[model samples]
Every structure is written in structure tokens, then in C-alpha cells.
Target: MQKPEIQQLLDKSFSDFTTFIGSLSDHRFIVSPEGKWSAGQQLDHLIRSAKPVNKALSMPRFFLRWFGKPAKASRSFEEIRDVYRDRLQHGAVSTRPYIPPVTEIGQRETLLKQFDQQKSKMIGLVGNWDEPELDRYQLPHPLLGKLTTREVLYFTIYHNYHHLHTLQLREKPEQPWPTQLERVIF
Candidate 1:
């Protein structure tokens, strides 16, 4: 709900995702079966999603204020998550820029390292703002229209799990990856 809490969620989710993928072999990570995203592509998409937030957070406060109005009322994390879930159910898909490449051979380490960097930047960025600042600034959301900074952080937390759930759903029953989802912390 607040910056520290949001930062913790952001950090833990990225760590959890990295740990999950780190346990998988290169072949399993890169191979997209039955037209679904491969484990590697899932990581790529996560990185893509986080990168923009880092950029947005780096902008001047004046610019952010000038561009968007303060939210009339803050939406709870569940409300934002449900909107995204509903959109996914109705056939919404990520835009082309946010979609990851299917193949990036021998790039897992690089991708994971970059992911950590983005995560650290995000945590630091949010740490500089208080709750009112978070509630006052708004960010554009593709599906939900507009969301406050706090709402965006909340969505990032849920977005990681949403992808993880989809990835787990695509896993074979016999595969160990499917079982890890049971222990998801977020």
C-alpha cells in the first residue's frame, strides 16, 4: 500500500522469479510449447514491463505533475488486479514493444542481471516518494486507462504473479516447474 511495502513486493517478486528461472535449464527456458511463452520469454516480458517503470520514475516531478492530474481516489491493489484479469479473460494482449523475443540464446544471465538493476533502480525511486506523492501522481495503464503511482506499483506486484500463473498453467503435469507455483510468495 505504501512505498516500502510496494518496494518489498517488487524486490521479492523479481527475486522469486529469478530464482524460479535460475532453477530451469536453458532448453526448458527457451522452448515455447503449444504456442505459449517459454520460460525465458516470460522473464523477458517481466524485464520489459519493469524497464518502463524505471524510466517513468526517473523523470522530473514537475513533468509528471504537468502531464497528469492527481487521482480523485486511490484504487486498492485488488481492484487494479481484477481489472487486468478481466481484460486478459476478454482477449487483451501486451503491446508489441512489451512482448519479449522468443529466443535470446545464452542471454539468461545478462537478462537476469539487467532485471536486478532495474529492480534496484525502482526501489530507490519509490523510496524517495512518500504516500501522498504516490497517490498524487498518475501513470497511464493500457487496460485500466490511468493509475496512480501507488496503483502502478501494486499492478507490478500482481503482474509478476499473473505471468507466473500462466506459465505454470502451461507446464506439463510431470514437470517440477508446475509445483513451484504452489509456493508462490506473492
Candidate 2:
């Protein structure tokens, strides 16, 4: 039973995340800004982001209670990347080896569809559960120590918005910048 407020947050986050991903045209996907990683890399990164959310969903209540939430349970900066890699069915998308595998507009559309579908699974996994999404009831983070399952939810959604902001900037670099960016400031 997800609380209404949190559920609203999750729903809005999902909507926003998809919108960000969808905005990228096939041409934009290939644009990595400075030959670093094109929008393609970022979009793939966003979809790959869902893998760990599902992995955490699969953990047993006992394991979660014992482990609490891992510091980087939501997104990979470095800490959780390997865990996410090991769990990936086909391995995480590599930013290197720069293969421009001619994925079509239809293919990109399918990927976005898959992203939303997988995200639905994630929402189902964490919804209204007595058990924590993280391995332990509480865990330590570099900035915020000793956070609970609920806090993990907040962290996860905010993390989504964090990247969305970056993606939005890529979408619109000319604008001076909106006074208020997408919601999720809390």
C-alpha cells in the first residue's frame, strides 16, 4: 500500500523520466555533445538504470532487513555499477567501443516502450510493502547517513530527476534556463 503522496511522486517521476527519454530524436541520440557519449549513450544509460531497481525488488525481506539499503542502491555513480553489471542479463551498455549500430527510429521507440514497461515492474515491486526495498531497514550514505526504506524511495526518484535535468539541458542548451526545473526539489 503506497501512501498517496509517495505514489504521486513516483507516478510523476515516471512520467517525467519517460518524457525526457522520449524527447531525444534518433539524431539527438547520436549527439554525445563532444564525442564523449551521444544522447544515445544517455538514453541507454537511463533504461539500464531500471535493472537495479528490479534487482532490489527481487531481494527477500530477510536479506533487505539485514543489509538495509546499500549506499548507492538507486543509481550507479561507481559504487553500484559493478553490482548492476553483474546482474544485467546482457551486460550494461558500454560507453566505450563506440559502435554506431544503426538503430532505427522504430527501434528507439521500442526501447522507450520497454523502459516504461520495466518501470511499471519497479513500481509494483516497491508499492505498499512492509519490507524495505533496500537490504537493511537503514543504511549509510556519504552525504546522508542512516536512511530508511522510505528515504530510499525519495532518493530513487530524486536521482531520476537529477539525470533528467542533465538530459533536459542536452535537449535545450540555448535557453538561459528555467527559474524552476522539474519538480522533485524536495
Candidate 3:
């Protein structure tokens, strides 16, 4: 996606996800099913994940260039999505830094505000770069290794959707819970 599209997706996806979380009851927001993340924790994880992306985007171009350019072309959104799915299938999980704490009902608004702040900061930073710059620089992804700035944006966009899907599933416990891979991938 171009920078404009990326910015729009970043806004819409996070907005939609945030709205959904806000709509949940206080109890549902904090409570998780067996071995699952509550809506609040999912929001927390998203905030954690976005921090580095925003940080990377906020860096001086010279700083980002330290990572070097992509050896191959940046992957398409679908490619990144597929690679992430495959990784999850093979037991990839959030590393320590990305894991969320036990979110409480009282902290719901605070977490939501943090999400808004991070999303807004990221969108603004994305506007500072031209299209080619997005493809020109690379950032380190914990699970995906080095990705072009554009690829990281793609991943960030999908990452929000992934967690949104997971939260959606949590809304319907009567339906059989999706397996770990299915939860995020499908």
C-alpha cells in the first residue's frame, strides 16, 4: 500500500478494534477464557507491539538506514500474512516483550487511550516519509526479521486485524474456540 492507504488502514483498523473493545462489558473486557487473552489484554498487546513500529517510524532516516536496505524486494501484504500464519502453525508465539500483563477492568479506559495515542503517533510519523522512503528503509520485526518500512506497515495493519479477529471470536464462546493458529490466521 502507498503511504496514504497505509495511514488510512492504520487509522481505520485501530479505530475499529478500539471501538469493539470499548463496547464490551467491563467484566468481559477483563475476563479471558481458558488460556486466552481477554479483550483488555489484547488491547495491551497491540499497544506493546505498536510502540516499536512507531519508534522506528519516528527515527531519523540516517538511524533507520543502519539496518540496511532489503536484500530482496519487500513482501506483499499477503506474503507477510502467509509467513506469519506459517510461523504460528509452527509454534511461533509472542516473545517476552510482547506478552501483555493481566489487564484489569479498571484499566480499560487507560489502555484504550494508550492505543489511540500510539496509533495517532504512528500515523503522523508515517506521513513524514515519501513512498520510496518506505521501501528504502528496513526495520527489525521480532518474528519476521528485517522488513522494509512498507512491509512493517503491512504487518502492523494485519496485526491489528489479527487481534481484532481473536477478540471477535472471544465474543462467541458457544461456538467452539478456534485453535491457536486458527484464532489469528483465519
TM, every model: 0.89, 0.59, 0.91
Among these predictions, the greatest lDDT belongs to 3
lDDT per residue (tens digit) for residues 1-186 in model 2: 244555577667767877866766566655444344454554455566556556655666666566544554333223342333354445444443323343445567676676677667767776636543433455433334445555555655665675677677655555422312232132
Clashing pairs in 1: none
Candidate 1, residue 48: lDDT: 93
Give the TM-score ranking, best first.
3, 1, 2
For model 2, state the Cα shift of residue 95 in Å. Answer: 12
Candidate 1's residue-wise lDDT over 50-144, tens digit each?
88887878887788876478548878999989988899889999989888876675888888888888888989999888788888888887777
How does model 2 fare in lDDT?
0.54
- Shift of residue 54 alpha carbon in model 3, Å: 0.7
What candidate 2 gets wrong by more than 4 Å, as runs, is 68-107, 131-147, 173-186
- Residues 83-183 of candidate 3 have per-residue lDDT tens digits of 99898889999999999999988898899999999999999999999988988999988888999999999999999999999888766756544453356
Worst 10 residues of 1 by lDDT: 177-186
Model 2: which ten-residue window has the lowest total lDDT? Answer: 177-186
- Candidates 1 and 2, the one with greater TM-score: 1
